[model samples]
Target: MPTTNKKKQKKSSDTAVQGTNDSSVVSKVSAASRGYFRDAFLQHFVCKVARRAPLINRGYYVRWRAVDHCVRRFLHITQKCPKKQILSLGAGFDSLYFRLHADGALDGAVVFELDFPDVARRKAALIGSNITLMGMLDACSPPAAGPVSISSSRYRLLGLDVREESQVEDALGAAGLDWTAPTLILSEVVLTYMETQRSDAVIGWAAKLLPQALFVMYEQIHPHDPFGRVMQEHFLKLNSTLHALRQYPDTSAQRHRFLQKGWEQCACLDMNHFYEGLVPEEERARVERLEPFDEHEEWHLKCSHYFILTASRGSLLEQALLAPTAGPICGPHRGPAALGVRPTSACLEGLGMASARVRPDQVLLTGGSSRGGRGAEARALIRAQEGWRSVGVEPSVDLDVRLHHSATPLPGGGVVIYGGRSSPLSPTPGLFKVTFDPCGSPAAPDSERAEAAKVRVEQMVCSGDPPPPRWRHTASVVSHTGRDFLFVFGGKNQSEPALGDGCFLSLDQQLWMKIPVEGAAPVARHSHSACSYQGGVLVFGGLSGGGRPLGDTAVLRPTDGGFCWGRIDVRPPPVPRYSHCAHVVGGKLVVVGGVWTHSDGVPGVVVIDVSTRSSVEFSLDTTAVPWPLMLHSFCSELLDPEEPELLLMGGGGNCFSFGTHMNPRPVTVDLKPALGAGFPSWS
Candidate 1:
């Protein structure tokens, strides 16, 4: 239900008989598809959970914290020192202004939230006259900027569509905007809901309206790899609940357009890389506690989707960030693809490798597997590559085989290895961690390499209480209360004989708590995929008991100390599939193909809208899909469109078939538009 009418005028051509026919047909098809996907994602998220849970809370905490980071950066960039006029476009239910004001990060700053009349009304009721809300009012329907008094400050709320150039100008005039002063504008998970042209117009207006302003925004970008395809699909499926889900196929290109329109600077970082930089010091010990999985050590790469960008009236702050100061990144990351190098299918798209990390010059890796007879030889081939080398961590040569998934570099010179699934009957959960650092690089000397390998174990924490253990369970790092927070979503639960509940760990507090969410949470499941977009977690498609499939989607948001849950409304693709991979590139969730069932099946891929919660089915034609089934073994990473070869190692898929035991094999899938060459570029 609720809806907002986009401003679109009928063209004279529409009156032509032939043009009318074509338009009518297109509208019918689009509407039908939108409904299907919206309901489908909602089934997964809301239909299943009735009450808030820890998983949902943690997911919200993760996304909200990310938004908070962007907000602060915007303030610093525009205000020239973190003090200035701030506006939240389409404020929705955003509580950042309130939270930040309460915490003192922005006690004296003038804050304004603009949204639809209804949303603004609800937000006012939820937090009224609470000092933070002193100058806050619903501007969704404001005829003009109306003045309000907050302490000694005077502010006004302007209800106008950013898409309308004249309206924006009027609102700016009414708000007493001074072009000479720096301003910070934030549009979080909002633009993707509008058409590309409209989104572009909004960006264009912002660049031209203010003299020195920074516009920090988050939106969906299309993926260009196999894992990306899978990630895109699940997102569409989960978002099918809302009818107006819009996907931005080219977020980077859009950024360029913003620059062309007048933004002086722009920069973006994928989710994994962003979190790696935000984690605090204490978490470094938690990351170093476990050893790298045998399999994880072999398949080394980082997989993440969401992208954060900061554009301003001045040059973007590209080279000013401090170097890694915390610990090693969790998954394996070879710094951004070397400059000027084009990528292959193995590489992903949408990740601006260069700006995402510190010291992107180094090739990062986690682990891989040895095929029969090809054991040493295969590894030799990998090592021989000009920019490739085996990860330094060793597997536990004893029991419990290790499967390396990915690694993330920490602020401090350390690496956090996340991969490995403990056996079902094993005492602990499937998740594991490892660290390697503080030693010179392998190029330093043999002794240095050995010293690096001899890393000291710090802190190890595991449990079946809050969030049970499960391989491939999605995790994201958030900053809150001056510390890094780790939030985990759905995955298999070896201890509970089912998928575990979601959990979050506070590095500063040294505390781990289960996320309490309402509405609906996914059923006890495993191998499900999750990505955070728009201040919420989008989880779709997974495996349940009896080998049944799950195509529903659930979203978790933070409320008080617990979490709130809401199911997405999306329509399943031609078939209901699970074990697929999901990633958030740009602002959309990309879900790539995976086993349709326990038995043989084909790759199923789709894309979900994070804002409106709708799905768009993309038909991809490929050679015979991978043999055997992959469960809890698939991973995906964001890629820059220009370079196709820099694929982040998605996790590995395991086969339980009773055949010649086979080690994990790395597979690369290409995403091409089925029936067509590729997705249509944004208008």
Candidate 2:
């Protein structure tokens, strides 16, 4: 009786862990039901599960979006090609197959989901019990008696211990998975729970079986960080060990694992940067406004610990999968869209101003001077398919000579520009508004631009106490408590050291509230690249108060009522520099040309993984990047989501010579090849 009781207790413990795994699916369904995001088929799988808490819903929403993005990319790549297969390892109760089928994105694709026997049997029972799920399957072959395995033309569900090599192989064979065909294997937070050897075997098995395939995995990384320690503790409390995390704690290690296991290319990015930069901005905005949220710090901390890693081989998987321009398949715009026009000449002296995309086809550029030491009054209208063109300055608008200001895009289709240096040593405190009228007259030729004006700039006065006058500060638009607020972070105030303070401007109330941070705040700096990442703002390399360049990075997260700052310590940090440009691609902070203390002045590009806090510096090939690439206004376009290209406009001179090459032609840097193979030993 004692032995039996012990066995029963062990079984109960195992069941609890399994339940926790299944609960994730329930959370996703609950989130979808609450309108956090749409997943019509998820409801059928969950079958009236209890709604998750708002925080859980948001986490699931982010997870769903990341996984969905990867799945959609796979589907888009295999759309026109021969029938491909997708294998979901430890799929649990995931409704991906049903969802994809419902959206008609699963055409010519076979899906196979594998999990432990107990979990799979329960899922099989659930499907068998549900007529709707059963009906969705084609004329499928009946499973062998008691074992729950369904095999169909398009979908297959199998129950097996994935750790058993023979069992996994047998299950795949029985499910009719074409090993030789192009395939995409998904392991979402699955392998981390398995022993290191077991997960390695699973990866090795897949690599050996699929000649042309892309393996995508979403799992926890950076287990040594403070947030990661909390994550570890939570899993430990749940009696589930993150077995593989210790072995591959960082993205670099994960990349190395894939490379060692025969994958030709591997790319990994944390959910924070991936969600912010890779996910569609429109989709992010829609889901962000779904629920009232104020846990900005928690959201970023959680996302920073989780990452998506993709490993690929073969040209088909390499070129097609994760390409940004791969548009809607099997629809009106079924094929790839034409690459848009590239900017030739942009302001070289706009060292710290904001550029907002006001329309799908247009971007507004304001507050920058020309290389000839003249403040630019005529705002530039960068149109799609057309190069940069000047918008005639309105005589009614009293524009000030401001540099280092921030321009934040409003939800109602406008931009709020605030805080910049009015003179060489003074900072301005007022805010400026720019609104566009699409119904206005078409833009006339360059000669008639003065008479035919369209865009308008208005200066506004606020009611609340504004922040101190500062320049080179960063501003990001974030949603808080069902309202949009503009968050401004560190910059230098005139005659004062770089200010580490931050504040938020409530657009509706026209109120400015200070964000009192609790943790270690970053040192005051200017000319830093601050971008909206996850639920907060990520500030990268900047110039310190003593006219010294800084290479540290920090993030400002909104806590329960106030805010907190966390500084990320990167190993072998990028050279201390300022007046540089940074862009987020996947999970990396790509730092472009900046003035370093070194003699070269313009060092090569630096790529830092925001997740693991590891960095790799790549010196630009003189043949590829034009020489003397300092102070250039760098912009990145996701021509392909998997591989983004960088464009450098203007700015090419040392500290001794200000704007020698004033109107430098744009230099396009194809980063795809560099990203693949981990930017290996660039000359």
Name every residue pair that clashes in candidate 2: 324-640, 324-641
lDDT of 2 by residue, 41-96 (tens): 66666657787655677778777877787888887877887789889988988888
Off by over 4 Å in 2: 1-16, 146-148, 320-683
lDDT against the true structure, per candidate, is 0.43, 0.66
- State the displacement of the C-alpha of residue 111, model 1, in Å, after optimal TM-score superposition: 1.4
Q: lDDT of model 2 at residue 216?
A: 91
For model 1, what is the error of residue 416's alpha carbon versus the real structure, in angstroms, after optimal superposition? 31
Q: Which candidate ranks first by TM-score, i.e. highest?
A: 2
Model 2 / residue 86 / CA error / Å = 0.8
RMSD of each: 23.2, 22.7
TM-score of every model? 0.41, 0.50
Distance (Å) between predicted and true CA of 162, model 2? Answer: 0.6
Candidate 1 structure quality by residue, lDDT tens digits, 578-600: 65666666555667655442111
